[model samples]
Target: MDAILRAAGEVLGTELSEPVDLGGSPRTVVLRCRTASGGSVVVKKYGTEPDDLRAFTAEAAGLSLRLAGPELLGVDDSIPLLVMEDLGSAPTLADVLLGNDPQAALDGLSAWARGLGRLAVASVHRRADLAALSAGYGMGVPSWDEEPWLLRHAAEFPAALAGIGVEAPPELAGELERIAATGANEYLAFTPGDTCPDNNLLTPDGLRLIDFESACYLPVFMTAAYCRMPFATCWCVFTLPAGLAEKIEETYRTEVVEAYPQLVEDEIWQPGIRRAVALWTVYLTTNLIPRMAKDEPAHRTRRPVPTLRQLLRHRWETASTLEEFPAFAETMRLLLRDVAGDWDVPPLPGYPAFGDFG
Candidate 1:
């Protein structure tokens, strides 16, 4: 740590203080530094491949133009480092989301939408640059609609339903296939591929978007899809109030449509919402199943051992909670019906089909 800080100081002409962990997947080290004149700065060192450095540089360049995010301090070789404004007063979007104030969450979502709208607008004219960034971030073109994840979920529907104690209806698979096959060749746009609340910070200035590592050019609808996942899960799981979900979706939809009128059609919004719900459901099911399977004994010991039939009934009863949002409910209904139908699916617009299912 000392050696890295020394090297950083030599490169930036600053004396570094102790390092702090920012707690991300790859674990970034954020160092607080001071120059000889006592000016404070923050430096971030990322754990990523050299190729990913290109994406970081591109994001820094994009943020530099908009002046909406932190400032780029410098880079040492291919290791892109950021010198950002210290945001000690602000809380992360995650912190705000975990708070009791629903209005704050709504405000935060609105701010996020506005920031994203600005980003989209800013990138619209930078076609070549945006494309390069997308490539650097690994968002290559191909259809992701009929990806194996879709198939795995569709094929595993029976097991999932059985595990949850619901009857796996056969017709729903076909409907999902049709829904997946329906949209192709849609106009693409720049999407912040990672829209997790943790990626947004609520500052005095407004909601500041951070972590552009996954930002890429993709179908505009997919952006909506990406953003809707956490929102739907939070609402469905009862972590967020029912009405707040509608507010969040409306704010996002309004901001995007206001910026790009081409996205105003119901076909666009409806499909995007459905895709979000479907993808989120698959994500949750995949993540939770193993845990549930392993923890079932402990879970059952803590509670009553309902029959598998009763258990399945409980799962769907809980699933219906997600249906509180009219759009989400409709999508769930359609997806379930599709699974029942054994439908042949097509690819999603603008994303590659990565075959890994874990």
Candidate 2:
């Protein structure tokens, strides 16, 4: 610990002390430390593990874009550590959503949408710049935008379902291929990769995002699906009240439409967004189903969070209605019948902020 603080202090030209551990994953150690000048800087040091290096590379490269997040004060790639401006304590979006004010949650959700949309607009053509910075950090990990998530997760679909005693439909492969092709379309933009609710801080100035470790470019719909699935990859899942999801989705779409004017059309917009939703449903099957063996909060510290079965059932219910993929829709239906249908859990409730709605 002394050696790492010393290394980080050298980068900032000030000795750091009074370190407070800021719970990071096994891949990194994050600290909120007081500098010699009595100010605080968050110092993060990545582990020697290969994936840790990749995560470090992504964060350093993403913050360098200055699109969002704390200002990157300094980096010593040799130690694989970062010294960043402290944004100070602020309530996270998760905090707001889980609180008592429905209106605060509503406003926060809209602002979050607008902020992410503008970020996508700002980062549209900067892939190579991100690539160049990434190479300098961790021997050049692959840009996650190009990671073939759709095809890879879809390919795993059949086997994942089979593990649960449900056989995938024969024509499911064709539907998966179609959505994967749409996933590869030209409407790409940069995202912080892990835009889960807790990953961003709702500061007085605006929503200042953090945790750029999974940063990469991806189709805009990959994120737009969050507003539809109402947060596809987040641990803070709950039912959105009537019309709330679409309203926020429009708040986001309104900003991105500035970059791609054709997004104004339902023909161009609906199909892309729905396909992204389908892709994420497949993702949920692989990522969440195995976990359904037990019931617990999706997050360790947050309440009213959905359980794995709750999330899976919600996703499958939505996917079951996809007009574009009959085979896939049928598959979702079968899972609903054989897997989550008999569970004793109540229907997933609305966000806690909505008070009686839940």
Candidate 3:
């Protein structure tokens, strides 16, 4: 804690005091503090491990891009800390979805979708910057040309499935292999590596993204697809009322086409988006199972991983809505049946539990 204040002071050129722990994993220290001048700021200090340093650098690189996010106040690579203006005390959309009125939650979701779309448009001319940000980074969003990290995860999926008592079928194994080989390069754009609602704030201006530890340039469809599924957040998978998701997609699509008309061609945009969504869904869903089922030190700091039954139920419900992908739907059906066994599943919570409204 002392180290964080000292780092903040060094970066801000003022003695920072009165820190409130903002919570973080083992590799991070997030604090909300007050400068000597009485201004509020957030101080994020990353550990010195190779992966940790890379994550911090990637975050700083991401902030350098003119995406829809918090203002980048000051960054120090040596201390690996970022000091920035606090975005106020508004609760995140995740909190709103858990406890606010349905309309308010819907409003926040709309803002998040629109914010991401704007980010896509803003990144249209930042190709060189995005490449520089990604160069030599230890970890980043998986893309076609560079994907060693995702390949490692693919290799572990079969064992992850086995840990939960489900035998991996040959077809499932083959699908995983196929996904590893596929890439979504043509539609690359800046993506918030982690699109969970927890990483954004519901300010009066709209949703403002906070963390960029995981942000990178990836297929624009990755964000669009994740906005519909709980792939990024994993814990909170609220079922939107019918047609609401499509409306949100349209909001995003309109913004992108306005920025880059060349991408609107039917052959390029439609199939690329759908295929990207499917590939991402498969990768995320497979990767989440083992992590969600087992408790680890990292999971201890965050929300408890949902039970296998809960995840299977969520997956099944999500798959049912994707009727266009019958094969994937069939796979979910098979997995759901295996997971159901004889136990009665619990009911999912109703939408809009708490948080900001206006």
Candidate 4:
């Protein structure tokens, strides 16, 4: 912990004190440290391993973009650490969503979606700049939208289904290939990559996003899926109240329309969102199918959370409704019918905060 703080301190040209451990993944050590001026800053240090360095580079590159996240304070390439503005004690969107107050959760959700939309609109013109920044960082981690990453995930879905003794539909591959092209050329924007609920702080100033390890540019619909599915990649899975999601989505759409006017049309917007939903559903399926043999929480500690089986079932149910991707829809049905039918998990439930609304 001292080493991490020392690296940050060296970058900031001061001695840091009062180090508090902020939990991190295997690849990182995060600390909230006090500076000489009695102010707090976050020190994030990445390991020297390949993937860890990639994450560090992406984060440094991302924060330097000066987008909606915490401000970039200092960086040390030798240890690949970042000293950033401390957002301080603010309740995160995840905290609000997981709590008992419905009004607070509603406000958090609306602000998160709208804030993301504005972030998207604001970031539309900075794609080349971000690319240059990542290149300068030298980790060579390609942005999600720049690479055919969704296609890679899509390709793995059939094999994952086969592992569970299910056959892939004949036309599923073709549908996935076509859908993979959605945000590759247009309608692109920068994203923190993992906009899970826990990563979004509902600060008094507004929604402040953090966790830029997987940050990159991606399709706008890819993010809209979060508002549509309401936290698509997050462990904080819960159904938003009926009509509330649409309102949230519209709030986002209203802002992003400034960058891509074509998205103002439902013809373009709705279909794109469906394609993203299908891809994300498939992405989750591929990642989780290998582990669903034993039921586990989506997160280690967070509770009232859905089990792996339940989350997959919920995703399949939603993805099956896509009219544009017939084979993909059929595949979701096949998974729902042939694979997940005997999982013995309960149906996914609404957010605890919204439980009373129903």
Candidate 5:
């Protein structure tokens, strides 16, 4: 912490005070500092790695050009720190959503959507800058769809099924097999890979997107898709006050379609949303199982063994067969077949193209 303060003070040309801990994920330690010129700043310290430094720099540059986040005061390479305007007053979108107030949640979601739209439009012409930041960063687009991490969810199916005290219908496995057979890629626009409500800061003035550690250029659907699962979970769990869920969903759907007219059709939106949900389910399930095993062993008996089983069951019950989520299911199926070898599965549709956006 002292090292961070000293480094930040040098970079900001100021005398920094002792660091204050703002405990959260990734173990962030913050400091309140004053420049020699009497300007106040906040510094955040994370691990020292080239990728981490690059993300900080890219976020600083991206936010500096827009009104979407805190100002980038400066960056210190020595301590791998970021100095910026102190936004202690800002509340994360997660906080607002958890309030369970319909109006507040809708407002926060609207703000988040608009902020994402701004980022996407602004990035269209900044390809060069984005390219440079992504170069050799080991954080570019995934070459294949079936990421190994996703298999962790597949492994959890047995546990989740047992926990739920139900056997997955044979149809569920069939759908999984079908999803593994179709491989396709469609480019939309860039988005932060982890654009959850928790990553957005809601200030009195407006919403400020935070945490660019997972930022990358990808299909615009990636944002809406990645974001939908949390929104769905939140809606499902809270039941919204009155008919607010319908209104919020309408608002989100309309805004997303208006912002990217190319995906107004179900053919595009359906697949995108499904892929987003399935992938996110796998992500959440995988993380949940390990955490459950360690911190909540008592609950483990009720927890899903194979994370994907719960997700698959949920998908089958809530959504139509994989036939309904064509593109997304196909992508998953293809990825699985590639990784796990061929399995007996019914024929599936060919990948559909929404034309080239690039």
Candidate 6:
């Protein structure tokens, strides 16, 4: 620790104070250090494991991307230490979801949408840079046909639901294939991989995303659709109220146009967004089934997960909002009918007042 801090200080041209440990994976260490000049910088150190080193190296490459991450102060690629500008102790969107400030939550959501939109627009032509970050890490852009997560999980559809007594329609299988095909061919953009509220900090300047250990380039609609649902990739799985969801989607779409006006004429704006939502819904639901069946959170990536009953309720409610996709609606209706008794318990305690979150 002392040697690394000394190295970081030498790189930053300053004396560093004691570090504050910020919890992260077992293989990574995050810290905040105050400089002799009173400014603070963040440092992330990787463990000696091979996977950790790969993730650390990839994150360093990701943080170097100008628009997607914080200002990089210094980096020692060998030890895989990164010194970056401090984003401060701003409350994450997750904090807002658990707090009483509805308006602040909305502002944070809008800021997050706009920030991601700006990043996607800026990186549209920077595939070389993203590819460099992904080299040897196997985390780069995934084609529709090559997306392991979608392919792995979507195959479990209809069949997996049957164990819980919900039979998915044959039409749904064809729809999933169609959605995946379209997703592979259109609206490619850079993605931070983890779009959780905690990863996106509402900094004073704007919203900034952190933790790029899994950054990649993917279709822009995939992200749009991911956020539209209950943040499926993240641990914070609660339904974003209807009005709030619409507003955030509008804000994101508006920024996409504002960032890349040419997209409007290319006819790749709204329709692509709709397609992404439908496709991602099918993709997310497929992943959600195993967790729902086992009565566990989809991913144990974070703490304070909703209970099994709450998880199902949130999934059903979020799926209910997908009326535009009749296939998803039918799938959800079947699951809800079959699993009604199992999820009969009330929601998890203190499940925030989303009714007023709009």
Instruction: Give the number of the best model, judged by TM-score.
Output: 4
Clash numbers, per candidate: 22, 0, 5, 0, 18, 0
Q: Quick one: ranking by TM-score, best first?
A: 4, 2, 3, 6, 5, 1
What's model 2's lDDT at 159? 83
Query: Candidate 6 lDDT, tens digit per residue, 1-358?
Result: 7877887887888988879987767888888998998889998877766657656656766777776677888877666677888889887888777677778877777888878888888877877875655553332334222345554555667676776677787777766666556657456677776787878888777788888876666777777765566465666656566567767866776666655565655366555666665555555555565566456653455555565556555556556556656776677777667675556565544326454322
The positional error of residue 186 in candidate 5, measured at the CA in angstroms, is 2.7
Question: Each candidate's TM vs. the true structure?
Answer: 0.63, 0.95, 0.82, 0.95, 0.65, 0.75
Tens-place lDDT digits, model 3, residues 125-219: 78677667556343443332254554566567667667767666556556655554555355567765777777779988778888777666676
- What lDDT does the true structure give each of the candidates? 0.50, 0.86, 0.66, 0.85, 0.50, 0.68
RMSD value for candidate 3: 4.4
Better of 2 and 5 by TM-score: 2
| Local lDDT at 232 for model 6 | 50
lDDT (Cα, tens digit) per residue for candidate 5, span 313-355? 3333333334565543443443344422332322221111111
lDDT of 1 by residue, 123-218 (tens): 555556654433443322221221344455545654665664545345555655544434433444454456566567887777777665545554
Q: RMSD to native for every prediction? A: 10.5, 1.7, 4.4, 1.7, 10.7, 4.7
lDDT of 4 by residue, 1-358 (tens): 7677777888999999999888888899988999999999999989988778878878988999998789999988888888999999898888887789999998998898889999999999998988888888865555443467788988777777888888888887777888886665679898898998899998888899999998888889989988888778778887777898899889899989999999989988988888889888988888888889899998887776888888888989998999678888888888888878878877788887876322
Kindly report which residue pairs in candidate 2 clash with one another. none
> How big is the positional error of residue 79 in model 1, measured in Å on the Cα after superposition?
4.0
lDDT of 1 at 117: 63
- List ranges where model 6 is wrong by over 4 Å: 1-17, 35-38, 47-54, 76-81, 136-148, 156-175, 237-242, 258-305, 320-331, 347-358
lDDT tens digits, residues 141-201, model 2? 5555546767889988888888989987888887798788864757889999888788879
User: How well does candidate 4 match the true structure in TM-score terms?
Assistant: 0.95
